[model samples]
Target chain A: MTQSPVVRLQDVTKKIGGRTIIDRISLEVYPGEVFGFLGPNGSGKTTTIRMMVGLMSITSGDILIGGHSIRKEFPQAIRQVGAIVENPELYRYLTGYQNLVHFARMAPGISRSRIDEVVRLVGMESRIHDKVKRYSLGMRQRLGVAQAVLHRPRLLVLDEPTNGLDPAGIRELRDYLRKLAREEGTAVFVSSHLLSEMELMCDRVAILQKGRVVDIRAVRRDSESSEAAPDDVWFDVERPEEALRVLDGLGKGRIEDGRLAVTADRKTVAEINRKLVEAGFSVYGIRVKTKTLEDQFLEVTRGESVG
Target chain B: MADFLRLLQNENMKIYRRVGTWVMYAFIIGIPLVMSLAIISVTPEDPPSNWLFMFIASNILASLIAIFTVVKAADAVAGEFSQGTIKLLLIRPWRRSSILLSKFLAMLLFGLALTAAAFTVTLVVGTAFFGYTASPEDMFSEMGRKNPWGYMLLWYLYQFISAVAVASFAFMMSAAFRSGGLTIGLSIFILLAGGLITNLLSLLDKPIVKYTLFPHLQLTSYLDGGPGPLPQYPMTLGFSLAVLGVHFAVFVAVAWLAFGRRDVA
Candidate 1:
């Protein structure tokens, strides 16, 4: 928590033609983590990402990248950031390698070997010589990542990066992004409407609705158990009634489909598991029924249509 | 400064790497040859003088060159928007003004290259058909200037200036609009009809006609040692260039304003 953030949005707002497209929203993305902006279509996810990367100007507030204000110091702030605003719209007339070379010339200190290294990292070396017009959407996406990372930016931002990828390609991108954050310590910021994808890819997520940050929280429970509130935990045990009795006064416990489900924090669940095991009961497994972002969204929107 | 050159390299790569761009260049080289060959077949025994042929061929080639460069200039920025690559192009470390300047400079370079190619082809074809009977010392051109070579060079220079002015106008249109087709069509329409508009507007004889862009679009008209394209107007090459300069400055200003401040979305 003490680490300085790589990107910070402080009450950033955007007004386009007298309409507030992005309201005042504040958040920070620290290094060595994957932050997500989760919202539905037209909920200002792309607007926020555009402001973060300087594609759109902020109206009322400021965004800082690597301690440089994006408004006052654009070239310096953008120097530390690499971003794909919506889709990876590259030059389709040029070959993939030419595209990489084109982007490499925009920033300083990107050698030919660095371009090759990024191509290999994205697994695009085989088709990197082909013209981008002949490439499939997934291939273009990989080349897009290669160009974005060629400069070795401190912050990498991808807005809805999984739009056209198949299942396997999406999984590969998720793994690569996590590795990018872990090994290189690059702060990866992604914006997506797909909750399952964000669940798998991001370490922390900020839920935006109507251009406002509704909630921001850590996604992984293990590394952030201190902030874990009470969630539904389903316990698999040998006894049906004894497990219920063990969790009698702790919280509301119910046996659902031959399994004991309790609404309790992680600590209470661990205590209940230990108590059931000590009372001559075999605890087979403990599953924390992590609430999906979709469920939270549904709760927040009150069953309204998200799309 | 070196980094700015690298940015220009990126712009040049985008400009020249396309198949269509090479096709345009081929047309620039081919048009004069085809015209010369047709002229030879039409008048086999009685070919025109070298200077006459050069003027005829250059008039046609130069107009074609202007149109070609204008088309390219129209695509300079609007093509990026059509292909959705402007987002990527603008997100780099450079400022928006620098990006627009690099693109405009590349278009100017393109205009200059096509002008040079057309000049070389016209001279070669003109000399191939008719011998260089008149030396550089001979009295030359419709104006009968003593230095024929200097007169021809000045004519082409004026032609190049006009083409660049029109092309820069197209560049401005490209930056301000999102549709490549509209930019190209509108620019060519104005170019092909500019002569007619200038003639019609000169009848007014008002002082404003001297200031309008149409009166100055045909800079090569001054090569005959005339005061202006419209003899009644009493305009000089210096005066015509000043008018064109004002127009060019306005186009560049509008392009920078539109490209610099607009949101990429």
Candidate 2:
């Protein structure tokens, strides 16, 4: 929290042909965090990202990267970031290695060894010399990731990055993004409709509807920094009724599904567990029931078509 | 400027890596060789001088070169849109104007390399088959040009300018419309129609013919200090060049405006 935000959008608006596509959206993304962007179809997630990366014009206000305005200082603002606006549309005629080399020439100071490093990192070594036309959708996705991180950018922006990835490839992309953020302090801004995928990969999420941000909140309730937050924790034990009564004073515990469900923070819940054990109550299992992102998404979207 | 070169390198890689581009270059080099050899075989006893063959072969090759150049220019900007690669290309640190300029320069370089290849083959084969004569300068000295080599050089320069004008027109269309086929078709139409309009307009005595682009399209005629290819106009070479220059500026202005202001979706 001490460091400045890596990306900040100030009342950014986009109007195309007299219709507002994005209406005064504002937020900030800091270093070493994965910020998820979510919206139904035609909700303007792609338009907002287009403006942030300097692909589209900002009708009002501004998008800043590393404190430089994208409108006035595009080269300066965009220089610190790497982005893929939609699909990773690369040249299909050239080899994957040639495609990487072609893009590496556009940015400054990207060495040959660095291209090799990214190729290896993305697991494209064996097919790096093959033509991209021969690559599968998932292989193209991996190559897309390789190119986006080739310059070691401070901020990485991806739109629908997991569109065609298999389960294993998607998992690899998630881990790679986390590693990039953790080790390189890169702030990742990603948009995907897979609520479950975003729930697993993102640190925090901003839900967008009708060209507006409706909510921004943490993805996981068990984050230590939010230890004071009362999460819905369930405990399965030998005596659900007796255990519920033992912790009744500390929290509002009730028996549901023949288990004790309590709304309490980790600290107070730990205290309740100690008291239960001291009273000869055996605790068999403990789990934090995270509210599914799909539920929250549908709740915020008001059950509208996810288009 | 160094950064600009790297962008140019990227554009060049995209251009030359295509198999179709190589085929275009092949026609450029191959057609001239075959034509020169045909001339030698048909009239082995007394073929025309090298300068004469050079002049005849150049006229045919220039039209082909212009078509090829315009095709590449049309693809320079519109191809990115068709391939959906413009988004990835534009998100870099460089300005939009810089990216466009790199593509423009690459198209021109491709044209230059093709023209140079055709010129070398035509001249080399033309001289070997027809045999060079020392007194050919006298034959071509009708319009105050005494040096045959210099005269041919001026012809090539003027031909290149015409090609530039055609490519610029094609480039403007593609940049503004984001449709390569439309630009290519329209440019080739204009190129072929210019010749027909020139012949048709010469028959008319109207003063409007003086300002028509068809008269000025063949810029090489002004090398003789005459009234140019279409003598009905009697306009100076400077006036013709000025017209082309103004048109060039207009094409570039429209291209820059459309490309710089467009919001790529």
Candidate 3:
């Protein structure tokens, strides 16, 4: 909590052709944390990332990487950050090792050993010598990760890195990103439409809708639960129909697998349980199922097509 | 400075790593060697061969270098955009200008390498075929310049300038367009037809052709202190240089501005 943020975007805005692509969104990503950026198809996730990495100009506000402003001091600010905007965008003709070496030359103090270390870190030792054109999408993605981390950047930003990856590749990338955040103490910022991946990989997520930061939620709910609804409470009882009858005032109840499932807060669940017990029903068990990020995202960005 | 060198190295790596680049190099060297061999084989037993003729023959090879330079420059920026590698370059610590300048320098070096290769081959083969002696009657003084070797160097200087101009135009197009094929195709068209268009315009006698880039690109005509290739052309060497300089500046400015503002989506 005390560590200073590795990246800070203060009221960043981008407008193109009289229409705002991103509107005054501000957030910070700390070191050693995986921050997820989630939005629908045209919700400005990539636009914000492009602005952060200096690929696109910010119409207003600024992004600071390691305390250097991207607009004012682009070279210095970008030196502390490594990013792949959309795809890996590598030189396909060159070998994967050559691609890494080519990028490493642009960064200061990146030695041969460091390149080797990153190559090993991404588990691309065997195929690093092969041409990238010959690499599979997964291999290219791993090579991308290796290239992005070669300089040990303070902040690593990847936009849709897992777009074309298989499930195994996505898992590998998630594991590697976590390792980078934990072992290298690098701040990892990734944007994805895959809510499950974001749930598994990120520590905190910021949801964007229509160029605005709609909500920033922690992936783990234990630290903060106020924003979370109580849960869908399911009760296993001797008499499901009796339990449902006792829960008439609550939300709609469904009986499945000899248990009653009802959407309720903690107090309502307790009240239902007490009523069921008083009404001659054996309340064997009660389970509260917390909502996943997918459920919350659908609820938050309701009525908008995911695109 | 060190960073610029690294950028140049990266550009060079990308350039030379392609199989097509090697093929272009081979063509530049191979075509001249074959032509000189043909000339050597067809000489009659009477007339003495002149080595300067080989240099003259090699002078035509400059256009080949120019064409190659045009294609390389056309691919330098636009090709990266097409292949999506520009994002990798754009995200680096170097400025956008640095990345572009490095690519330009790499293309320049490529043109120079081709020119150098052709020059070496012509000189070596010309000496071997003609015994390295200049016949007084055919001392290349009729080419309107004495000292054939010095004249050849002057010819190369002018040719290099023209090649730079062509490549610069192509580089500008490369920055402006996302399609490498479009950039290369349009540049080759311009390079091939540009001079003819200027000559056609010159016949109109409207004085507008004097300011166009094509006529001044024949810079070698002014090397001999003569009236240049087009006697009807109304510009002096200084005027031609100024015009070419203006075009070069414009080409570079267009490239810089386009590249700086382009959204690398």
Candidate 4:
């Protein structure tokens, strides 16, 4: 079976003011998946996203959205992609509804009802009648999101959507975005510096460092036991030499600081313990170390220098 | 076509919503009213010749409207870039040329509307206070019994054309300089300083000074006879039009090329 990605960038490079902002970055976001783009500040996450949506031209590379080449069919590519780069500026004098209506007109075939639907979806229905200048920062962000998704784009790209939001507002935005991707089956590519938010919200994540994709991994679940479970079974044995022999036999274990760390299923740990006991090695204790997303992210992105 | 209309509607909405626009309108009308009242209270007989009155009124109104036009159009593209809204618009399924053209047309319309409003008020007030009658024949007549309908037509066209020329220059400055204030200041400086530079240069009695854009920007002067000691020449009119055309074309070309290649980050 072949699955087409909602958004894809191939060897994208962007140079600005004699510096490479995005350096040969390639990424793919699958349909109906929330792909988190996590990076430090100035890591080219926003630049990459902007190029994907045709907001900024690529210095040297190609971006495809919904099977359309961004350079050749920018409007078609952009038609399927909804994006908010940095702060989403709105017409301050117009009401929230009016702003949505104005943007909606830009998207051909979008009706007034669609505008109302998006306003309600973003939970700005109550305040949609008020002028945008009266809106608080969170309210404006919500309206920005509403304007982005009004045309029901297949791929939604948001750059730091929760930047200035309060805790409550951030939570609300997170929940709203989660529900949006889940219910609408839209592919969401969200770039943020907040790793914890990505861990909580994204189905999968691509960690970027200095315009390079350092790692791509699925979100770990605490309750589900699987082969990919990041729990390292650490065994502290009496004889480090014998432990190494036994761990070598296990084929997936590494000895570090007199302990045998093995990547194995929960049931296999007991077999390894029995083998260590059979080999005349005293096993002091066995502990399962759960790996956090931050650990994985740090491991992937560490030592990468910015271009 | 629909998109163009929508853009025009949005532009009009922006003009109406801005506080600056209203302030400019009030100033345009207010100055003419004050001037009319002052002239009426001071002058006992006919206030002045129609040509003199027109010259004074056109100069004042055009100067004010031109300044406002520079301010408004200077920010047309630059403001969007600063406000971070250009990305949203550019990401839409629209061509860059269309967007730029829409803005240019909107600014042109804005200048024309402002001029019309000021002219209407000034004409009414001047007629009421000065009692200067302007008949169809007077409109057609020129100095030394020369038929100036062609000149007047050229003058009216220049009302929009010169404003467009100023707008184009402002746009170029806007594209080059990201700051709205700097772009506006530079545009106004050029608009006013060009005349000063030309006047200073004319003291040398150089022939090339006639070719400068500043010497012929006065579209109204053509309607009156001509400017300075220079006699009316078909070459002068042609030269002025050509210079302005080139300035306008160069401004737009540079703006488009710079804008098209710019990084919107």
Which candidate has the top score in lDDT? 2
Clashing pairs in 2: A40-A307, A41-A307
Candidate 2 per-residue lDDT over residues B1-265, each given as its tens digit: 8888899999899889999899987887787688877876887776777777777787788999899999999999999999888988888888889999999999999888878887787788778877776546434545323566777778888889889988999999999999999999999998999889878887887876767666677898887676777665678888888888888899999999999988997
Candidate lDDT (C-alpha), each: 0.85, 0.87, 0.84, 0.77
| Superior candidate under lDDT, 1 versus 3 | 1
Number of clashes recorded per candidate: 0, 2, 0, 0
* Model 4 segments more than 4 A misplaced: A16-19, A227-230, A233-288, A303-307, B44-55, B128-157, B224-234
Instruction: Report RMSD (Å) for each prediction in the order shown.
Output: 3.7, 4.2, 3.4, 4.4
Model 2 docking grade: medium
> What are the per-residue Cα lDDT tens digits for candidate 2 across A47-126?
99999898899999999999999999998998888888788888899999998998899888999999999999999899
lDDT of 1 by residue, A1-307 (tens): 7999999999999998999888899999999899988887898998888888788888999999999998789999999988887888889889999999999999999999988899899998789999999999999899888888888889999999998999999999999999999999999999998888898899999988888888897786555656458888888888777779877767578988888888887778778877888887888788878778778767775665667
True contacts kept of each: 0.83, 0.87, 0.81, 0.52
By summed lDDT, the worst window of 10 consecutive residues in model 1 chain B runs over B136-145
lDDT score of residue B3 within candidate 1:
92
Model 3, stretches more than 4 Å misplaced? A221-231, A236-287, B44-50, B143-146
TM-score of 4: 0.86
- Report the C-alpha lDDT of model 1 over B1-265, residue by residue, as the tens digit: 9999998898889889988878878887787678778888998887776676777777877888899889889998999998888888887888999998899888888888888887787778778867775653233455534555676788889888888888888989999986789999989988888888888887776677788887688887777666777777788889899989999999999999989878878
The best-first sequence of candidates by lDDT reads 2, 1, 3, 4
Q: Please give the range of 10 consecutive residues that has the lowest summed lDDT in model 3 chain B.
A: B136-145
